[model samples]
Target chain A: MRRLSPPPTSKLVIFVVIAFFLLWWVPFSHVLPEGFPLRFGTYRTFQGSMIAMWAIVALGLNILTGYNGQISLGHSAFVAIGGYTAAILMVDYGWPFWTTIIIGGLIAGGIGFLIGVPALRLTGPYLAIATLGLALATPQILKKYDGLTHGTQGINVRPEVPASPDFIEDWFGIKLSNDEWIYFLALFIALLMLVLALNIVRSRVGRAFVAIRDSEIAAQAMGISVPRYKIIAFGISAFYGGIAGGTYAQVVGYVSPESFNFLLSINFLTTIVVGGLASILGSVLGATGLIVVPELPGIVSFIPGAGLPDELSWAFYGAALILVMIFAPYGLAGLFHRLVRVGPARVAGVLTPVQGAWLSWRERRRAPPASPGQTGAGSEDRSSGDQPGTE
Target chain B: MEEFWQQVVTGIATGSVYGLLALAIVLIYRSTSVLNFAQGEMAMLTTFVAWSILQWGEYWVMFPLVLVIAAGMGAFIERVIIRPVEGAPVLNIIIVTLGMFAILNNVATWRWGGIPKGFPAPPEIEVTGIRFMGEGALDIGPTVVSYHDLTILVFAVAIMVALYVFFQYTPLGLAMRATAQNPVASRLMGIRVGRMLTVGWALSATVGAVAGLLIAPLILLQPPMMMGVLLFAFAAAVLGGLDSPVGAVVGGLIIGVSENLVGTYTPKEWLGPDMKLTVTLLIIVVVLLIRPTGIFGRRAMRRV
Candidate 1:
């Protein structure tokens, strides 16, 4: 089987340059025609930055969970660590913005490395349970150390104003507000991190991670240092989570234990799962799903008396997750792949009734006959067995 | 010394609740390698069902009825939701349970509102002072043991004995154990493995409901009240070994004692009340580091 080669490095370079230009100029008030209803200036910029932050976190999680197959329920703990570190540095030490962000990532990465050393020994549910404990414990620890974290009261952080006048006006087409400057900074960091993640995934370390995910024992047998790789994945993930946390703190201008609860962890997991697990583009999709799906009820509430109770959204989200797991196990990324594969054929009118019937028959014929005593009625086995490239 | 004894008794009582939930977790893990993260929420939901039933029925009538309803609910959930993902990756199963956690918690909140509800204690059992260790120097210790502690201890012990007999002596228990150990072989021997798995879930839910009911009086019942308990229960389950029932009980006791002791010694400003969860997590980490199999759990030989 021939592996699909990634698009050329020159193409990626061109893409990055174009992306940077668009991110900077496309969100400006002067760029859009007057009275363009779809023209969202600052809001688009802010949302784009938030999406970028989530993409970074998802990419980090992809390394640990998607690549290494090690489940972590405590990724948010690292995020909290990053947020708190940045908050403390800015508030207490008066550290420079860029310096604090770097320090935040370092602190989170160090913590991740230490945790991974002990935690990587376990696998599957044990790892999850351990991480879940860590997630629960972090907020408490933060609250307990009130002198440092400010307890539940949290620490307020003022955003750093950009020093460059040309850069600021070019981006926003006006004198940049503190929030706008922070947003652009976050957007730049997110884009840089995303490119870095893409490069890493294409590198040898990424292949080792995939190998580890596919089979730990086999990876080890093939001379892959499982524990070391696992730790590296955790460290890298923490770094991204840390950046995301720092960015979020900068945007919100507040850091609290309540902000980094177990629900956030679950939401993050939901984002990754719904977005497309291992796929890079899927991370963005997942983050969108996380943000958008929760707001669906709020959107619905706009209709005259048609809105569901706010609590119903949680249940709906839960049900949506279950349905996705059951029906679309490969997630929206997989759905996109399937659509891409079938789109041309469908458009060409090749899927006629006779052709469809023949295809169905062939599919049935190709499927291995069920064994005796196999009560294979559920759709789960079908989805699992149909998963690409497994068998 | 008296305070120490009082803490020990309190620990045992709290440990009993953890043990009950842990036992349920182990049972589900035994049959289906899925750790039910929703166990606490499910239990809490069922206890609410029992609470609703008690509005009309007598206390005695509602107690047994609630257990039955919980068992049925457990079995139904296993059949409807968990059965589909029985053979998927461990992570997928975990996510499924988490989904269930969200659903059940939301459902409870929707029905009961987010406010805390008081758990009613039976009038007969409301006697304040029934000294267990005599009333002299023992009562003058760090924390005095209450009548509630003795009642909880006795109730926990009774449940344990009943469970022991149910699993060891009953044919259904033997069949369930056989299925858990080797599902294919059990199926080949003409046992209904799927049904047994469902039964396991039912039994687990019943035990979870019992734990919920037992603890509700001590802690006010709320939609998210059981979340904390679930963490401790998960720690207890891991500490006792994921596959062993007896291990869950012992693990719970160890966790309960350690949490109390740590809470007592740690400065009020440090971990404080939240130390219970942190201490439990620390114990779990330590246990996994030293002996992944857990105390009283048989070492599993993994094929490389």
Candidate 2:
């Protein structure tokens, strides 16, 4: 059971460091001989930036919704605020890009804290409605302040060419396009946030959040200030959203209320759930799904006649969602944990009775006439709660 | 004064649409503590079905056909997508609904395209000699009313009364309320809890479908048509008291009328037309601060 947990942090860090070096060689995949199906493309960079950007936002939301036990259908408003703040500063004040991002995040965090003060008393459905209203109104409010947001015309930034471009050209003798710049910068920020999130989740503050989520009354009895922690959680989460939004504005080189709609908020929440609630690694997996799920048909187009019809993707996507929820309530992270933990348990005789009963049940299903008595006993055992699913 | 009276009448008529949609929301919430974020999209899909039926022939036939189809669709959605997440964490249940929202919106777009098609409404109200909204000397009365507006008001009331009777009088409705109150107790009493939930979804869907049919003609049919209507309805439900059916209706009427009056009376310089959505947010936040359970909702007591 001890070994079943993810590998030690130091070892995992070493592995990631090695993988980081390996990533440098990926861009050269295009030089492969003709007829080789695999290749690297600029689209991959854009997709990579999207994944990193989404991961950042999803992680933020996971803290508020997952850890803190609040529902927000309007984090997009925070994202918009962060984005517009950075965009306005850049377009109007000519501030350094990095400085503007920090300020943008601060503003968003402040607003989130303010919203949290009132939100502390509301329950699930009511909180969700408030956030939903925020998502709907953010765009209109942005438009209303035409003097600042440019009123739907949107504000665009001049292309940014970071120091990494020069370093890439000097070291690898390759040009760093704008997409790659955004991707690497986003990657750096996402990694930083992931580490910060991982630290926070395992810390004392993180434990307080989980306590409140599990049972607010119990948490209060344990001397936790539920409202204070809840507000702090909201602020921290908004800070994450704001940073992600600032980078997003840079990635697209434009900022508009249209960019952060309710759909974006939903997708952010979806990724966090599909990835795994209460897990940092789950945020990454969920972000990947958010980018890939809609494009599944195009990704699988290589197989003959396997592409989903354009009109039917939603039906299939919906069906997939229902199936995943039924079968994988813990999402990708839960499945991975089970595979690791259960695989060893089976090998080490930890689940011998259950395994034996399952194998015998399978054997009986294959040949019913000869195996009635054995299967009946197995069913009796299952009824008494030795099945793997009973837990 | 005529303009003010005219706006008041317009408010109630328009508010009726919000009332009906709010009832749909309350039905599901009462049965299951879960909020179905996909309610509007579900209604929109069925309305599109009605639009297709209209292609076959006649106007009135689409209403009955849509109601039947929407009931089944609602039940199917509950069993397929919603039921599996039952008793799971609240967050998981919400995620399922959000997924449903995405799937429904995308499917509707694929089928209906993004275009807003002009839907011919039931009938125009023939006006005799009354010009009220424009200006000057005139009488502020229901005599200036349109047939469509009359139908909206009538339909909203009739459905509310019918629903009230169903819940208060019928055994099935009582069982549903029981299931909502306590599933274990309901099961002990020989009520089929799962079937009751499916029925609840079906009934809620039917109500939403009616609202959809009524609104589609007003907005012209489109995939995203019900979004604004859904928002207002949500406000109505919350304001009237989320757990109270009567509260939802009253909340809806208040929201509808106030939303109009504020826009009509206030200066555009202070609160623009876009402020309507903002007003909704303000109402939701302020209401929760003052009375978290809403006007008609009973306060929930929690035990440690």
Candidate 3:
């Protein structure tokens, strides 16, 4: 039997070191000399901040959809709540930015809990539609109550967005631009949330989530309060969404009803699935990919004599999404893990067993045919204990 | 009282269009268990095809051709894009449909440009010299309804009846129904399950195309025109029941009527016309709270 374990310690250390270096370098890379090859633009820093904000929501969504097997097309509402909370606190009540993030998170989590109680009855597509209702209603609710949300015109927080403290300039000998400062702020919060997500997925609470997802009855039999854990999952996920929402306000310095539309929720679901569901790293990778993939045409156009029209950018994005789903069903992180495990030489052997596992698992749940018993038995042997389906 | 009746009449006309699209969505969901988010986009694309055909051909001539083309496109998509990920996780299939949505919408915008085109309704058909559909309104008791809205309602009813007949009486429909109920059993019984699925897509696309054709004249033809209707239709499908065809149509009618009524009758201060959509969706959520499987959906039995 093959035992799955982390990569060798030396390789892990190198990976961590490189990741840390990139995170540390991104905010300051804009400061590099104009002609330097390593120099990145202020725009890239801003994009990085957006990616960080998006990743926070992706992390929360993955916990619900990926780990807990609860699909939410309504996360935009939670994010909106968090964002509005932050914006209202900062702009209306004169609250500091950092404290507002926590408040936003708490408020969002509370509402998530309320939604979850009702959601306990729904499963699969039904649950998905129920949450989708939340997403659909968010903008209307935001617009109808102009007194609170500032209506369709949206709220601007640019003046309230905090500038970098003078201590940073004195201590680090680096004077950061507004975009760079925002990027660092978002990145720091993302890192903190990422660590918390990692811990949550590894702890006892996380195990309950996975078990409940696998089989609710089985989880209940194992003394896991299914509803409690499921609701808790929603709360935690919404808290993360709220935190990201607060981060969005800090980063974008604006909030509007239109910003939290249905498409945003759909994109969040796409991010987790495309990133690799049930993965912390996949969430980050997906958020980065979501931001970067649309820019691919622009990036490719830089090549001499090779260009894709800007109008076709969305078409290209759609094609990329399809190709990725067909070829790399487990997502970019899954592809990355597979490469790391097998190395480049054995890459061709990637699709067989895992795909077989999913197919056979589905078949087994349906009425098993007696004719293909041999192949079915063979497939079941490899997939019995470790299927990745949400059955 | 007159205004209330008028809203109801108008609501039924619009709701029928919603029902038509929702019926298409339900058709795919029932047969393949995959919610085609791209259903509206598929319809929109076929309507564009119809618009192009109309440039040279007559209205009646373009109609059947567009349906055939739409059916073929649906089957082609099922075979090429959907086949590979057939047995994967549900989320994977959903994402693929969304991908298709993006692709179709973008391609249509790219091909046709974003300008809203004037797509004529099924041109004034003079059946028995009575003028069935044309640029005129008919008074029925307390309310006057436009010929286009009446045409939409008629098309919707005709399609529903045809579908009911197909599913109940035809051999091909039986095989498709069997395939939907139990693919493994249907395969063991020598039904070509794959062929049935392809046919299902073809049938669903035909229904959706009818919806697009009927609605384009009301909302004008554009790439993004179906975005709002698609959401409403999705809500309609869920409201009626994902698997029940009748439920989808009934759900659509209910939503349509309630939306209009809510807009007209609700208190104007905080929850009036602007809040109608929110109220309608809230009603759906409330209904779902009572019936998780939808109003007409069968409760799925689990063997835990």
Candidate 4:
């Protein structure tokens, strides 16, 4: 019998090394002609940046909904707050772009903490309803505070232009445009966020979050302050939303109440669901879906006899969500994980006849008499158990 | 004082519409335990049906026919789309409804252009002002009520009374209540729980259609016109309690009055005209904080 062991950690190390090389070299140096149309590098950079922004938000949402088992429908409100705050700071207060970005995040996180104080007492639909109200109200509030937010007219932002005298003639060796710079900045933030999120998921705090998500009562009995943890999750999630909003504002170069509508919140949540709720990589996938899918209807309009209205994009998303819930409940990330696990296990011949027999006997022993009530209870319990680490 | 009274009357008229929509929402919630986000869009579609009917006949004559069609469409939707997800997770159900929201909105837009369409008012009520305090000429006198406003108030009250009678006295209503309380028990009692649920949807659609028709004359009919009304309806539903029909009506009146009063009296610098949505949201948040189940809702006990 040939025994199979897990692949060595060195394999991961090598993969990362090669991945980084490709990420850096392929876009800028190796993969393109001198004058490629539309500049694939710039496009990739922007795409990467947008993905990073979404990943950050997804990580935050994961901590709250996935890790803490709290449902919030007002996340886009936080994003709007963050974006508007950054814009105001940069335009009105004469704050540097970076400073405004950080401040925006902190402000949003603080507001999240306040909201969470009241929200922690509520659960399920009650929480969801409260957040829904918030999402609906934020745009109105923005409109009311027109002096601050510029109301329906919206605020326009100028990209940060590098001030270098030596390279003024040759653009100071800055090959990348302002849009490219913003993209790279967003990407860097995303990478940092990804690393932090991964580390947190592996840490004690992450474990506590998972425990709480699995069973708040159980976690509480085991000495976790469930309310405190829930608030922390809210704060963390808001923090990510804030940064993402700021990044979005910078990239779009415009901020409006319409930009952060309740629809955006739904879209973000859908992204997380479609990308796989628990997986970090799923966030990236979800972001990609969010950005790319909306463009499909528009792109298809160019084809003869294939024109679709812009609103069809939303319908497509709705259909996609339904299909995903019905068939791929675990999402793309879950599917990948299952494939990874099952493929290796099957390849390694892990399941022998004796093992199969043992497993079948175990399954039989575990199976309870099937009833509608029992099935409902069983699924509920399974969901409850799976709630932790969902983000 | 005159302006205040005018605002109050206007608020009440608007509140009646919100209350009607809220009642529809409550009916659905009570029967299904699902918040129908597409309620406004559904109502809009049904109202459009009513409008199409009006194109061929008189307004009052078309009303009943529109209601029947709306009810049938509602029941059809419940059977086709909502029934399958009865056993799904709450989030999944929510997503489906959101999908419906998108689909219905787009469908309406596709059918009817984005331009607002005028809805003809019934000839029985005109826009003439009625003297409340003998045509008061005082500097600080109450505002005169318009005949149109009175008509709306009367119609709203009549609908509520009819609904109360139907729910309190009818067999179908009892079946619906039973299904809402416990579907399994209702099924065991041979109550046709699925049919009751479908009826609930049908009734809700009918009520929502009426609401849309009432409001259509005041604000021209458009694809997105229902969005703001839906928000107010949500606030009313939450305020009254998600499950109680009476609560929805009362909550709508309160929200309507308070919104108007606030708009009239609030400091110009603090809250502008747009603050109505913000205020409604604040009320919802505050109410949830104080009582998550709502004013009239009984606390639900979850089995672990």
Among these predicted structures, which one has the highest DockQ? 3
The fnat score for candidate 1 comes to: 0.60
Better of 2 and 4 by DockQ: 2
Q: What does the interface RMSD come to for each candidate?
A: 1.9, 2.1, 0.9, 2.2
Best by the lDDT measure: 3
- Rate residue B184 of model 3 by lDDT: 99
Give the TM-score (vs. native) of candidate 3: 0.93
Q: Alpha-carbon error at A256 in model 4, in Å?
A: 3.4
In candidate 4, what fraction of native interface contacts survive?
Answer: 0.51
Error of 3 at A47 (Å): 0.7
lDDT of 1 by residue, B1-304 (tens): 7666666777887887888888889889888888888999999999888778887988678889998999999999989998887776665677788889989999999998888888765334323674342112234346656555555566656766777787799988888889988899999998999999999989999989988887887899889988878878888888888888888888888888878877776777656567767876887788887886677666766676
Candidate 1 backbone overlaps, count? 3
lDDT (Cα, tens digit) per residue for candidate 2, span A1-391: 0122332253353344336423633653343555565556667767778788888898899988888879888889999988998898888888878887889889999999998998887877877887788888888888887888898888887544243457777887766666676777888778888778877776888889888988998999999999999999999899999998888877778888799887788778778878778767667778877786777866676688888877777766766666666766877655545554345454345776777567546545554365333434234322321111100
Best by TM-score: 3
- Provide the lowest-lDDT 10-residue window in model 2 chain A: A382-391
Fnat, one value per model: 0.60, 0.57, 0.70, 0.51
Task: Score residue A249 of candidate 3 by CA lDDT.
Answer: 96
Candidate 2 at A39: error in angstroms?
2.8
lDDT of 3 by residue, A1-391 (tens): 2213342233352354248536746644757777887566777777888888999999999999999999999999999999999999999999999999999999999999988898999888888887888998899999999998899999998899999889889999988888888878898898888878877887899888999999999999999999999999999999999999999999999999999999999999999999888877778878988999999999999898886898888888888888888877888767666556545433455556676566446655654345344355334333332233221
TM-score of chain A, predicted model 3, versus the true chain A, to 2 decimals = 0.86
Instruction: Name the docking class for model 1.
Output: medium
Ranking by TM-score: 3, 2, 1, 4
